[model samples]
Every structure is written in C-alpha cells, then in structure tokens.
Target: MLYWWSKFVLLGPLLRLLCRPTIEGVDRIPESGGAILASNHLAVVDSFFLPLLVPRRITFLAKREYFTEPGAIGWAKKQFFTGVGQVPVDRSGGSAAQAAMSTAVRLLREEKLLGIYPEGTRSPDGRLYKGKTGVARMALEAEVPVIPVAMIGTDKVNPIGSRMWRPHHVHIKVGEPLDFSRYEGMAGDRFIERSMTDEIMYSLMELSGQTYVDLYAASVKEKAAAAEREAARSDARDAARVPGTRAG
Candidate 1:
C-alpha cells in the first residue's frame, strides 16, 4: 500500500517527469511467481529508477544502517526506505550474511521480486565487476530464475557523491532469465556457485555494455584507498624534508 503510494503518488511522478525513463525487454519479467532481478549497480538512484519503472513491486535487501540511524530525520529516512520496499539486513558477513541469504530465500519462496546487486556494492568506476556467489546461492536455494537487469544513464542522473539528481534520461534493459535448474540442490557447492555467478555477471556485462572487470568492486575500492593513503604519507614525508616546514 505504502509502496504504491510512494511510487504513483509521491516520488514516481516527479522522477518520471524529470528523467523520462525508458525500459526495454520489460515484458520479459514474469507476471507472477518468484524471480531474482540481478542488476549492475551504477548509482544510488539505480534502485529508485528500476522499481519505479517496473510494474511489480521490487524489494531490495539493504544494509541495516539505513534504518538504524538516530533522530527524527533518521526516522523519516527509515519510513521512506520502507515505503519504497526496501528491507534492512545485516551486511557484516559471516553469520549475518547467512541470515541475509535466509531472508532473501524466504522472500523468493513467497513469490516476490527480489532485487540484488551481485557485485555486493556499487561499481567504483562504472565497469561491471565480478559478482559475489551469494546471488547464485539464493537463486538455487529459492529455486527461482535470475533475470539480468542493466540500469543505464542513472549515474548521470545521480552520480556518486552527488546530493541532488540531474534531469537526465534513464533507461533500463532487462535480459532473458538465466535458469540454473541444472544446479538445483547444489547451493553450497563453491565451484557450481562460482560458475553460476559468473554466468549471471556475463549476462549483465552484455546487457549493460560496460567493461567487465574480473576483480570485485569492493576489493578495487580498498586497493585504491590504500594507494591514496600511501601517497598521502609520501607527501607528508616530502613536506617534512623541506627546511622551513614545521611538523604539526
């Protein structure tokens, strides 16, 4: 109820008018039954635009922090996320990851559309990154089809680190569902999971036309951060070597 209200009544109209969003292969989406919409993460608005354009309600599993912040503004954010069909899950990994998987499987079994970013996080440089195997595990465990979705032009509309969205056209490309029924009941097999995940990532790569990077996005971001820190340290050392420079 709230989801529809937010979509049609509040945010959806404004987004539609500004971005003039377009979607291809939307008919590929199942009219009923559970299925996984595996998408390439581009920008924060990727979540907003995909669901806004899709006919059925798409529920995403977001990190718990979005719902746990303190104060009235936090409460408002929590309400907004909830109304937009996002469910908060612990993303800290280990047991928390297993719990999230369980929640996702449960949702799928209930015949709901579940949106997942197989890369685990947004791409740092707009290239498609290797997908995490959790998406494979969920599809196999829930016995659902995985549909590769590509969100285009969303980064332009809402680029990384931007507080406001620009009026840019957005497009969504939906690919044919990849059936992993061949690997049914083999959810925990690492080798099978890797193969399935790779296949899904390949579909995303083809659909989005983005360069496919075999490395994980999170790892690349970590390496870049480490490099930046090292450079900063080197700069500090060079500054200290200057004769009149004072150490703070």
Candidate 2:
C-alpha cells in the first residue's frame, strides 16, 4: 500500500533518522478496535509522524484536493493516501461544514481508527485552538473511546510554510483513553455533544500546553493575515526610504 510503503519505506525511515520523533505514552493507543485519535495538529509533518509511530493503520480526514489530482503523480498520491487509509474531505469554500463530518462518521462506523485534529487545522503558532465538537459527536455516536495525542516540537521541525524540514526532536504524547460510555445513547442530544467536546478540549489543553483559543484557528488566521498586511505596508515604507535607492 502506498500509505504504509511510503511511510515505512520512505517517510518513516527518513523521519526516524532525521526528525527522530520521541514518543511517550504510546501504550495508551488501543492495539485494536475503532477509536478516535483526537490530536492537536501542529505541522504538516504531524500526520506523517504519528502514523509512523503507531503500529496499527490509522486513517485521517484530509482535504479533497489531496485526493483529486491528475497524471502519474496524482495517481501515486491517491494511491499513497488510500494505502495510508485517508479519506477525501472537502474543506474548501462553497461546501457545508457538515460534509466533512459525514465522511468521518462513515469511517467510524467501519470500526476503524479515525484520526481527527480537534483544532480542525494545524495551529498557526503551535498553540492549541478550541476543538470542534465533531470529534465528540463521532465518539458518542460510534460508542468508541477518544484517545488524546499531544504533539510537541513538531512546528519547529517543519513550520507552517517552510520548504525544508529541520532535524528536531519531536514528542508525541499519547494520553489515556477518555471514556464517554456514560453518554451512551445520547448522541443526538446537542447538550451532550457540547459537554463532551468541552471535556476533550480540556484534556488536549493540558497535554499541549498551548493557550486555548475559544475561537477556531480559521478566525485566528484571519486576524493574523490582517496584521501581516499592516506590517507589510510599514516595511514597504521603510524600504523605500533607503539612501541611494530609486523609488521606481
């Protein structure tokens, strides 16, 4: 399979020799069964790292673009994702948010390990954001355990838009499974979903130690973008005033 082949034969070996992800509490992950590995996304490589460490095959909900491509490269990519057990999720504009959830639910129903980033996206500054309630809903609906995975130092290994990866010691701390059997048969209840989501976020917050933003990362990115525009304008003015430089 492209997934495990690419990971074990390619990325896994390279990362092991390079980034050298240090794992902790790995025993927390259930050796078998369909449970949700709810983790805080830190870097692009976060997905790559976690799978390598976990012995069992884990699947993730990735953007649909990853699956929709053309030609040999595209085909290989599709094969890779499929081999690794990733599903195509449409998280772009003009799509309903629930669309992503629907696909994920189907995966859970199959009794597979559904790896979800509770923060929805990778943390811009490696700080954990408010987890979307979808993880909770899936756990409650599927009657499965929610495993919290706290990833540290991955952002430094591969930054948000970095073209290269640095050799850094990363940590993947797998937390004990959070039992939600008490909420069995209460999946459709809105109040139960919210409460359970909050509980999962709390555990993630403790594990990540990133300032928990009550708002989603998308909102935070918007604010950050606005700030960057303002800073860019200021820098442009400063660069224009350099001596002997023409303002063409």
* Leading candidate by TM-score: 1
What are the per-residue Cα lDDT tens digits for candidate 2 across 1-248?
A: 67768778877778998877888898888777889999988898888888888887899988788888999999988877777668887886455557877777777788788898888788888677887788888888778999999889889989889999999988888988999999998887888888888888889889878788788997899999999998988787887899866433
- Would you give me the overall lDDT of model 2? 0.84
lDDT string, candidate 1, 1-248, tens digits: 98998888989889999999999999999989999999999999998998899999999999999999999999998999998999999989899998999999999999999999999999998899999999999999999999999999999988888999999999999999999999988989999999999999999999999999999999999999999999988888888999999544
Candidates' C-alpha lDDT:
0.95, 0.84
Positional deviation of residue 60's Cα in model 1 after best superposition, in angstroms: 0.4
Model 2: residues >4 Å from true position, as ranges? 93-96, 229-248
Q: How high is each candidate's TM-score?
A: 0.97, 0.87
User: Can you list the residue pairs that collide in candidate 1?
Assistant: none
Residue runs of model 1 more than 4 Å from their true location after superposition: none
